[model samples]
Target: MMHKPEFISPDWPAPANVKALQTTRAGGFSTGNYASLNLGDHVKDNPLHVAHNRQSLSPFLPTEPVWLQQVHGIRVIDASTSSCIETADASFSTRKEVVCVTMTADCLPVLLCDEAGSVVAAIHAGWRSLCDGVIEATVNAMPVEAAQLMAWLGPAIGPDAFEVGGEVRAQFIAQDAQAETAFRPQGDKWLGDLYTIARQRLNTLGIHQIYGGGRCTFNEPDTFFSFRRDGDTGRMATMIWLE
Candidate 1:
């Protein structure tokens, strides 16, 4: 029996022209641990199953999304002309049919668009990328002014569950002293709030309209796939396209 995929929309007041969806682990054709709707082709899941899972998402997309070979770096690609897999953490498109997509398990997925929906972008923001300026790179790549862009944060590892070592804490602190507020001492390690860090970065960029940061992938096993919780797991996708 085939189950339908579950998706979440941003709660912020977005323009009607903008459309976005966050895929859950509920539906598709992958079996076993990948067990349906596994959109990440790079993962070790069976290639056939991954293809089927990607096909399941086609009906909901305006066009085939420009999937990037995300390398946890700060590179942003222009999806309008990109052909091959680009080593970028984010992608933006001004055309309506060129959907921007990112796959993640615990890492933050951010969808962005202008108020008029003239452009859209999808960013994969893990701690390493965030510290390296993934959010800044995406914001810079956007065609709209920072103030005119609205952002929606998708499921990620929450602060309470995202424990890290001293090196992780120092990485951000070295960039900005105020980043210390996003971390708290957990024994000899620390718990980092990726959402907060992302927000701060956006705020610094003059992007104030933000939403959807309450979900935690690591804790919500039934609804999402968490790499930290399940070592070999499928990936949920966060996608955005103009209607």
Candidate 2:
């Protein structure tokens, strides 16, 4: 059977050697709540089903993707040498055929590559990681010039649906006063624009070439897994590699 993969390419002009893909919550052998194509092994899904699902994705990737433990912190691991699930939110690799991957439900997955395709990275940016500087950490870990780097924002909770408390807003506001613009008043709560905040962070790091931030996982249940929508949903994977 052929597996159908949903992928988005960054709009910026990247080197022909760079390749990337984002998987949707479709086309797999998982059952029940997972249903199909659930890539997260730690999400209470059956290990056998999860293994089968991963095997299905292997043909599309050059090699096994470097999966992270994802502690929602700013550490960026060097995938070329890391063996274990490094406690980090982002990972970078200059080695060809080693895929850098990030798993997310509502959290944003940001893929990065330079103009020359010499390096590639995958970031798991939830509110905490985004506010604490995961994007900045990824950029700093890369050897490529910031101006030459391009990014693609993957599916995430839309601003209209991502309601948060004042403390969440304060976390970002404390980082950059201008971050307040990404939040909109919603009664006693605030609707946060994760995409806009990510863009601002990248722009501050000098990575202006960015794309693919319009997808809303929370609303698109058929195509994506949303943690905010379904508390125990499976995760979708966003992967990047240099060919």
Candidate 3:
């Protein structure tokens, strides 16, 4: 019997029809640094193992997820209409059973849905994309009012583990001076908080209902894949869809 993969269901008050799944770095076939449940194919993991890992998720989802070629940009796509893997950092769907997914190791994966369960989105928020306004782009794409949206921040490099230089800090501050609060001085570097920054962004868009944070990918080796911690590593998938 196959050991089923483990998942983290978002702990939020999303409508019963809006479903979400967050994968961990466990219970698949890829071995070594990509060990077990490595869902990303571009990380140099064995192709067959990658295929099997993705296939294993089929039972839990209504359909295959629309995996994007994330480039740390702010592009958002409609998963309901996308037929091929698109180069976008975020995807949303208003239709039922159209799964939107974003893969990340240390980068923050954000899942969003409206109070009405009419739409849901998955965002790939690396520091670069976060700084560049991926969250804002996705919110803009959604037909619902920002106030109707609730966001769930997934596992990522926590503030204590994500150290960055002055340049990275500068970019975020340039957009919003309040972003400074999300960083703390660490010698010449700064420890950045992806969750805080993400919440700040969502709040700015009138989205106040936020949940799920404090899980650290970089610090949790056994449970998560962190690109910063392990250069040659797997990726965890965060997915959402309307039922």
Model 3 global lDDT (CA atoms, 0 to 1) = 0.95
The residue pairs in collision within model 2 are: none
Who is ahead in TM-score, 1 or 3?
3
- lDDT of candidate 2 at residue 42, scale 0 to 100: 88
Residue-level lDDT tens digits of model 1 in 56-118? 888888888888998999999889889888888999988878889999999999999888889
TM-score of 1: 0.97
On the 0 to 100 scale, the lDDT of residue 162 in model 2 is 97
Candidate 2, lDDT over the whole model: 0.90
Segments in model 1 whose C-alpha atoms lie over 4 Å from true places: none
lDDT per residue as tens, model 2, 138-188:
999999889989999989999989999999999899998889999999999
Off by over 4 Å in 2: 1-11
Query: TM-score-based ranking, best first?
Result: 3, 1, 2
Q: What's the TM for model 2?
A: 0.97
The C-alpha TM-scores of every prediction are 0.97, 0.97, 0.99
- Give, for candidate 2, the lowest lDDT window spanning 10 residues: 3-12
Most TM-score-accurate candidate: 3
Q: Pick out the ten consecutive residues of candidate 1 with the lowest summed lDDT.
A: 1-10
Candidate 3: residue 216 Cα off by (Å): 0.4
Query: Clashing residue pairs in candidate 1, if any?
Result: none
- What value does the lDDT take at residue 215 in candidate 2? 87
